[model samples]
Target: MRIRSNTGKIASVLIVVLSLLVTIPVAYAGDADALAATLSSGDRADADKVRDAGRKPAEVVTFLGVASGMTVIDLIAASGYYTEVLSVAVGEKGKVYAQNGAFVLKMREGANKNDNKELHRMTKAQAVKSVTDAGFEIVAEGEMLRNSEDDRAAYVFAEGMRGNTDRFVLKSRKP
Candidate 1:
């Protein structure tokens, strides 16, 4: 019974993953160092660098349809991981609104909150349902956006990003 249940869970997860793949578009096409290079950019913080392996920042941002000059809201900015990535992706003119969940907000009210002030360069606010209600449709949401490791575009520049040869695809959508 346990074996059967585990298999069922795996199958269900696979179904969700496959559905995400169908909806999300690739961010890297004929591009080479461009995609990986952006992820590995020195502009990113050292802390963010360590998280790259697990978070797959490049793939995640691209999947969200993030581009230079986008006004993005990092719904849950826990220590600004994705917020930092969005900052770089959006460029100076563009903006990132970093909002923490209720727990994080309550924690921030504590005493040890040192002056890690750069986080404020981004606006702080929760993005309520208003934007989506105003005609913005969410393009994609998932843990991983790349269709497959063997896919040509997903792993092409992974080495440049640190021995990660995951090609990336760039489905045309205006930046």
Candidate 2:
């Protein structure tokens, strides 16, 4: 897909798809807290809700610095699991490109008729590295903290550790 240039920004903001939390930033900490509740909300289907234990959608979005009104590319969006959560996170103004892989398409052909595995096939690790290498700075290190919201936040973090998971966030460096 051809991305049109917006204000000549060098593809700075990275919306990572960890399939996975931030604790460091005081301001954004509340983001993780609030979003975790949304992820675990009754709004989600029972089948999808139960998977939160393993997927940790809230934490992943927070760590990746996702917000409302930003276009996100949900690479390898299997069964559109992350895609659903991202849609909520990005709100109506934002858009999510839920691109899945060929293997995923074949496995779940009924999922989407336009399935093309080659569409956005980069691995999560590669995505992280590419963003960082492109001069994207990690402005914060996310950790789910303890508080009244600890239970929900912890549910999002799920034994938080820096290197314990694949989630990441980065921003473009100013030239």
Candidate 3:
């Protein structure tokens, strides 16, 4: 009877120790609050308003499965609006490519040059800087659709209302 009791106590202690070991990794993985705070700080005022108005950055980030060490591509990242937010979500080990189509340059070249120029001015370097400032290395700029599949981004944020609505489309490797 004493032997059985001793064995039961050892099993209980083992279970408790095993549970603590399992939970420690999950606790240390990431802090959502810290990430959110970083996002709110670097984000623009209007973008914050837009985020507050309808979109939830944290939710969107989670839905996209963004982690600490993944690469993302922002399609037609106008004015680096979502770039700032994505940089914060992906963290230091992650990267973001803020791409623009040729249409942006072409449109900026003609009659609407003044307005388009301002748009490009705000978006160009700032987009790259945002990720770099967040401790990510920025890749070369250009269109994403033209890139090879391996060089392609893991996630794509398509701006405007035409494609994929307001949500980001995520691409994952098949197991």
Candidate 4:
């Protein structure tokens, strides 16, 4: 579905698809509170703590349905801020891989600094088609992250692509 922003600049898409095959709930209320606690923990670096306001790691992870004991990967982990959060969220049972360089380079070969590149573009229709084409059924979809003022054509981070860009999430599983 196309969601238009209030300003109507341009609809930034945030798609989420989940397969009914999985019976597990996306997130538990307790888990969300734990994630919030993780964000406020003193173990996190002071610098990283400050970034929480903008990054909203807890909210992002919660929206992604990241729960305890779920393996997760933080590509382009940078300073391992997310890695730490995932590790704690996943507890000792699950694993969190924080990787960069070649691994990240491959997934983002043509991605520009501003994170705006045609090569990385995908319309909502195309995204759904791709998921179905992969033999998975999309059971759930969500517009968790949408920013209309986001200029997808912008070519540099200096232009404010950090939190200004739209992000989509999808959940699917094999039939």
Candidate 5:
């Protein structure tokens, strides 16, 4: 989905990783060199390239163990920086979904600028429960995306919060 929010750089980094592997021909999966190439490729915007050093998207993807032919979903993908990275990581065979909440987009419009009631975010416990309730077994939780400096109270899209907010990677398996 497309997002029109005035979300800053932090929104560019808000990624919720959900991965599922499948057998498919992936040319560049799990290759560090390939990831680096993707990052430096001329096709990418210079603005995105400037942030690569700090965001460490490659390291975070590797830490999450994402590989070729893995279906991945990136939630709150504002500038779609991670989405592009993940798309290349997954290769031609995999699928990547970049999602931005409707509420967030709507809130940015002039008509609903003050409509805070429509904004709903799940707590960590609630997020876990929602997945467990859906019959998926929790397999693992990845902490590579965690930032110790974040006080956990700042708005996720707040300035200076880029790559500094608590993010959970819930790996689950079906019975």
Candidate 6:
């Protein structure tokens, strides 16, 4: 009887421990999904297709040296493609700055004359909200082609014509 009682107690403790382990991972996965959703709403199918075709967001972010709580500045954040991913990777403690060029906004305005301005405005607004929602704050805005002496960006990510190979330039502040 004593041995049987001890075995029963051990089984009950094991069940409780197993239940906790399962629950923890599920909660973490749910949070990750929520963060991903907040970053991009575009047909993930399309993003996946694009990523598969060339560079993936995960790879790009890794190349950019984006660490949690570090500040990242994204240049020419047209349509917030990379902005969403950066926000999620940075988590709640980090910051992501989405900057766009005047030429890009003007081009967007020219392409869709009817709603270009509205769309451009909406894009910037949404990009800001996307990062903020993912727990990041916007630090500054500027053009990618133009260099600012005091930009002090921990890392700068940009989309070039070719692909992800040369699309990013990582910069560190001088001590």
By the lDDT metric, which is better: model 3 or model 5? Answer: 5
Poorest lDDT segment (10 consecutive residues) of candidate 1 = 119-128
Error of 5 at 141 (Å): 1.8
The C-alpha stretches of model 4 lying farther than 4 A from their native spots are 1-33, 74-81, 99-116
Considering lDDT, where higher is better, how would the candidates rank from best to worst? Answer: 5, 4, 2, 1, 3, 6
Error of 4 at 164 (Å): 1.9
* Regions of model 2 farther than 4 Å from truth: 1-30, 107-175
Point out the worst 10-residue segment of candidate 4 by lDDT.
4-13
Tens digits of per-residue lDDT, candidate 3, 1-175, equal 1111122122212211211111112211345455565556663685464553344555445434455556666655556656666666656676767765555334332333222222212232444444445454432232311223222222222253212222222222212
Local accuracy of candidate 4 as per-residue lDDT tens digits, 1-175: 3322111111122213212211223343236566877678757888888767656666656656666656666655656777787666666666677665553334433323332444344555766776678687765554545566765666324445655455555665677
| C-alpha lDDT score of every prediction, in listed order | 0.44, 0.50, 0.40, 0.54, 0.61, 0.39
- lDDT per residue (tens digit) for residues 101-136 in model 1: 564555433323433222221111111132234444
Per-model TM-score, in order, reads 0.45, 0.49, 0.41, 0.61, 0.63, 0.38
lDDT of 3 at 165: 22
What lDDT is reached at residue 115 by model 2?
A: 28
lDDT of 5 by residue, 1-175 (tens): 2333334322322433344443353555455666777778848888888877657677667655666787878777666888898887787778888888775455543643443221222345655676667777666776656566766666655687755565555566667
Candidate 2 lDDT score at position 138: 44
Where model 6 places Cα greater than 4 Å from the true spot, the runs are 1-53, 108-175
List runs of model 5 lying over 4 Å from the truth. Answer: 1-17, 21-34, 53-55, 69-79, 93-105, 108-123
User: Listing every candidate in turn, what is its Cα RMSD in Å to the true structure after a full C-alpha superposition?
Assistant: 14.4, 11.8, 23.1, 8.1, 5.9, 22.8
Question: Cα deviation of 89 in candidate 4 (Å)?
Answer: 1.2
Question: 65-163 in candidate 6: lDDT tens per residue?
Answer: 454555565555667666666656666676677776665455432343232222212233444454455554444332222223423222222344323
Report the C-alpha lDDT of model 2 over 1-175, residue by residue, as the tens digit. Answer: 3322221121112243231121122222228667778777748788888767645667757666667766667665667777888777777677778775565455442433442222323333454566567655444544332123222222222456212333324333323
**Considering summed lDDT, which 10 consecutive residues are worst modelled in model 6?**
18-27
Q: Supply candidate 1's per-residue lDDT for 116.
A: 28
